[model samples]
Target: MTGKLTAQPGKREELADILLQAAEGMKDNADCELYLVNVSEDDPDAIWVMELWRSAEAHTNSLKDPAAIALIQQARPLIAAIEPVKLRPVGGKGF
Candidate 1:
């Protein structure tokens, strides 16, 4: 899934850091194929995250994981809004 989120003013970096931590935590999760984060060049408060999961069920179950929950809790307050982007993966070089 692809998502764009706006951080609370002045908290973009903190949000990115938390996402990076989440990426680290996902390293051992076989269900998670990708957990990529990028900051928007135009919007200072905007950060984008791209995720590739083995399945929808896998992604849902991940939300209940303690480590994932902790990261979400840390990031919740810093997030102003989250907008999901509709995209499908066919094939890619890095992917």
Candidate 2:
């Protein structure tokens, strides 16, 4: 899943940092295949997160993780909007 998140005007960097922390926590989860966070070159407030999980269930269950839940709570106030793009992977270099 690819997620586009717009942060409050001045909170982009902070939100990115929090997201990185959350990704770091995911390192311990075997189901998390890949997690990458990128900032938009044109818009400082825009951030993108790319995630690949072992399965849809794993992705859904990740939302219930304590660390992920805490990160979501912390990020909620700074986030303006969330746009998710779901994709099906056929084959990938990393995978």
Candidate 3:
């Protein structure tokens, strides 16, 4: 899964920090293969997150986690918009 998140005008750095913290907690979930957060070079307020899960179910269940839920709550206020894209990994070197 991948997502593009636009932060409120001056909240980009705060949003990015929250996402990085969330990624650290995701390490506890073995099914969460990869969780990456990237800041756009052209647009400071634009953030991108990439996630690789063992299954769709795993991704869904992650939302139920207390840590994940808390992070979501924290991020919600700073996010202006969130656009998600689902993906299937046919074959990839790291995946």
lDDT of 3 by residue, 4-49 (tens): 9999998999999999999999988999999999999999899999
lDDT of 1 by residue, 27-85 (tens): 99999999999999999999999999989899999999998898999999999999998
**How does each model score on TM-score?**
0.94, 0.96, 0.96
lDDT to native, each model: 0.94, 0.94, 0.94
1-95 per-residue lDDT for model 2 (tens digits): 99999999999999999999988998999999889999999998999999999999999999998888989999999999999999988996976
Candidate 3 Cα lDDT to native = 0.94
Clashing pairs in 1: none
The clash count of every prediction, one per candidate, is 0, 0, 0
Ranking 1 against 2 by TM-score, winner: 2
lDDT of 2: 0.94
Higher-scoring candidate on TM-score, 1 or 3 = 3
Off by over 4 Å in 1: none
